[model samples]
Target: MKKKIYIYILVCTFVFRIISPAYISASTVYYDEYVTVSYVSDISGTSFPSTKTSYLWEGEHMVYKFQLSEPTIIKAYFSWSQSDEVPGGIAWFSKDMYGVDIIGNTAAISSKNKYNLILLEPGTYYINYSFGKRGSYKNAYNIGLSIAGQKVNTNTLVSASSWENPNVIRTDFYYEGFLSNLQPSAHYLFSVSSKSYVTIDYLFKQVDNLKADSAKCTLYYRNGRVIKSQKYDTRDTSKNKIAVLLEPGDYYINLSDATAPTSLYVIAEPRTNTLTQSIKRYTNKDVTVWLDSSYDHERALMVSSKVTDSNIRSNTVWKTSRNDTCLVIEEDFFTVSENGWYTVRTEDENENYVMTTINITNIDKVPPTTNIVNNKTYTSKSITIRFDDDVSGVKSAKLNGKVINYGKVVKAKGKYKLVITDQAGNAKTVVFTKK
Candidate 1:
């Protein structure tokens, strides 16, 4: 009975050890506001960093909990006053209090490795830091946290005040930011009120001897959908420019650098509709229209027309022009020689289009014909004259060089001069005798 009781006591002890929570030596620190650090531990001897924003403690491990409202890039910098007084440390990002490491040890902290740039999605996150081993000389280490893109307002739309004049390409709508080993990217938010062709121009220059290997810019819809993205080497001439057609909506621009610190100047300019006149009319002359030279690239121009009793073939022309390049379409360039309705449309590779209609009218060489109601060679009553024009409509009529209504009767019984004109300036004169 004594042996059985002892075994039962050992079994109960094992079960209690399994059921109880494990010991956690790390203390948790919560940061609710920008650059405000709050400590929750009762340890009295703990000290803080020189810069009140950083955490300085001699503990072997520490955990920081912070909430991010939007996707952000953060920089975590770890340092110590004396390199020999502290051992190396490691920091990682996790989603929960003790969740699986999302980014493990990419932020290894040592005297040589002082900082790490972390891109994080919106959520509550934990920064778990572990000083590899306490050094012989018990000294406090420091961990500083900062937001890389803090200068940008993630929720607010960049002011469109400078975009008031959409016709002119304006660089006033721009964001200037610095990138470094600590902060390698910047984010910006903007809105487009209408469908437009937008141009993004950037001036990226090296701030240090460490030249960036590559630079990239990505455009995203307000809903987190990627609209377009471009990446370029720093040496590429086209690396500084991006042009795209965007629909009306909100968007995000993320500019990133790789391997070096850079100074960035980004501009977003929305090009408005250039075709002001939708319809143009010309009579007895050649039709000519100038293409918008704002976009200095090649585009497809389609011309379609149906002329009366003519088999005119429609054609598409590719026009390439630049600031220094001139492309001229000669006079009377329409394929149709007769009068008809023509449409000229210009389209880009993205299928964005602008169009104009041309109404061409040939010369009406034939004058208006007149019909006399009283055909008698000698008439004692008044006579009525009716006028009609085929091509151009009848404009006006005059009797004896004085304005008179068309198809009106004349009561005077004497020789009279009747004149009629058409819309195309074709005039007709008649001599009649009303006796």
Candidate 2:
């Protein structure tokens, strides 16, 4: 009785736990915000310390400091004149702890962009800006910043065309799970079972002028061998690129910029559906060619066939692009001076190739016929059969589940003797009674 009571208590605890809500820590709550910083140096003849909201060319670095009551997140935004090749800018953090540094060569940030900074336990941070060279024209911008569920400031920081932009700028706290930490120098393989082409969408940042001719693409196989190399040309202003016709296999994608070392990306899980020779046949006369195309995108259809012998007069018998499943080749008449092997291939929409073989033998193909006695009625327990042409092979007959035998060998029942031949042996069945 005591043991039963103890077991009952254990079951109650398990049930109670299953119905209970999970506990969450206070740190599980995420905080997010945005910060915008525009630099328009004193290029518009606008004087600072006057009606202008920002300084044009102070000739000194501008720093913004924030004191924190608790740890929070921050992001900075800015833009430089790309229209006239104005000096570039870079940004980084200058706090007591040297927490987070977000800096890249001077570039445009017209679109809403964000970069990550370190997670602060509790501290102050100063965002500083420096331009490479100031142009003669001051640019306009609206920098939006947010911190710990709050907006940092609404003011715009414009730089004069006379000051240089920093090498890097911007900082923010991102959701721990939201960003991908993949480096651009990694390669991976992708698998696509069907025998077809593959397309890859490549995303990259420009290292130097967009007109650089050294911007190229390099592909590497899993064995670390170079497979293909090609140059990229695009008129689209968008920053994404695409590559096509890559066989399925793990590969390394290298984006070579004229200005810097090549960046690499990984492509995992490669696959292929390639065509290979299936059979070899010898033919002096026209023969129908049949191929297997089961491993393609859809049904296999005849694409094209090439004639090797100039004297062979044969026309295309049948062809289709609507995925006929079976890859077949038909010829009106095959005429050849010499006997050799012929090749047939099937292709998918993506141009993946599948191949099959055919062998042409130098044998006579005389039509063989069957002669049935007592046309309508066959022997009660035996069937009378005769062949128009002499049958050289002896085979057994099977009906339903019973095997019938008579002598050392059996004659062909008729032209339609239901003959099935293989390398092992030959067999023919005679059906007299329906049952």
Candidate 3:
């Protein structure tokens, strides 16, 4: 009887050793390093949220880390497959591995889903999850986590200056994660090197029974002062926009109170100096008028008889070219059929004027006249000749096809040929004999 009992005890001890190793290995299947949880869209229906998942078996655990740049209210979600027999799982938020729980532990029970809304400050945090040893069979458990609130740190910087292209920044604001009780907001930062005109354009899309009145945007100074603010309704389209002139400084823009996702575009255009000058040109030809400034599609060249007169024609070709290093010139072509003084002006959307005067006249066609007559006898030792041009003045005079000073005295000893030409390329010739 003692020998039989000894054999049974040895067999039981061997079985216990084998089973203990498997239990230790299963309990130690935890992640040594924490996985970072970044925001990712996993939205459905009217909820705009991001989700991250981790898997664990019975008696195993996992940890995830996330950082917040600003104070935000976030929703934490822990869920698993509904088909599997309900496994006992618990999750909690903490500042570190050994820190006390910021939000008390939440259990995943027969419901298969658990969520909590907690406001967190700007800092790094960790979420720890564990599957307790309740079920005898090993089963995989999926844990889902998410956060939602003001995403102010995700800002786009805008530089609005003449040298750079018009700055346009765009973004989409949506409710993040699975939390529907809290709305999402976005923030943007921009700087104007000088005074500029800024336009804010946005499109609001209703999410599952949400109205447009739930959306709004505000512009603020760097010092937290409000500059301009507007709300949107169902009728608010991209065409409905806000325009404001901002001084040289940094500014902030915020969009909030949105029940649905919204798309927004902010355009900042720098102010330009007006160019005022005059040009004298001949009619029946095309003349190019240019200014050293940036190009804008909204600016158009306008033509009229007087500065104050209503514009008669605005059909002019405008083009932009670079003439020197960092110098841009905007040029417009103007043509006239008759002679007159026409005002050519261009105005930006902000009503800033750039204007010039064009004095047009017909080309000189009449030739110069002279006192010398053809086949006339002149016996004097020296003769004085005079030249006159009515329209364009006399350009030059020639004697015997050789250019000479005009109004100069000449010797009248033999047959002489004289020629005169005007500034308009008109010429006249005369032949005379001296006896």
Which of candidates 2 and 3 is the stronger one according to TM-score? 3
User: Compared with the true structure, what per-residue lDDT tens digits does model 3 show for residues 1-435?
Assistant: 111110101124453243222222223223334344334332222222336565666755455566775544444555566464444555556665421333433434334445443445457776655565623336766655454343322222321111133223432232221111222455666677765677777655543333457667778887889998887656637545778867678776666665344456667676544433333432223444444344353454534345543332322222223211111233444344444565545556666445455555545556788888877988888778888987667778988778777677877478778888877677888888777
Q: Which clashing pairs does model 3 show?
A: 49-176, 49-177, 50-177
Q: Candidate 1: lDDT of 27?
A: 33
Candidate 1 lDDT over 243-322, as tens digits, reads 77776776666667642322333344443323222224323334444344344333434343422212112222323243
Looking at model 1, the pairs that clash are 379-435
Q: Which candidate is the best by TM-score?
A: 1
RMSD of each: 12.0, 21.1, 16.0
**Each model's TM-score, in the order given?**
0.50, 0.33, 0.39
**Least lDDT summed over 10 consecutive residues: which range in candidate 3?**
1-10
Question: How big is the positional error of residue 255 in model 3, measured in Å on the Cα after superposition?
Answer: 5.4
In model 2, which regions exceed 4 Å deviation?
1-102, 106-126, 130-188, 201-216, 236-248, 252-287, 291-342, 346-354, 358-393, 396-435
Measured with C-alpha atoms, the lDDT of residue 205 in candidate 2 is 30
lDDT of each: 0.49, 0.32, 0.52
Local error of candidate 2 at 422, Å? 11
Regions of model 3 farther than 4 Å from truth? 1-40, 43-73, 76-201, 204-231, 235-262, 266-341, 344-362, 369-381, 386-396, 400-402, 413-417, 428-435
Q: How many clashes in each candidate?
A: 1, 72, 3
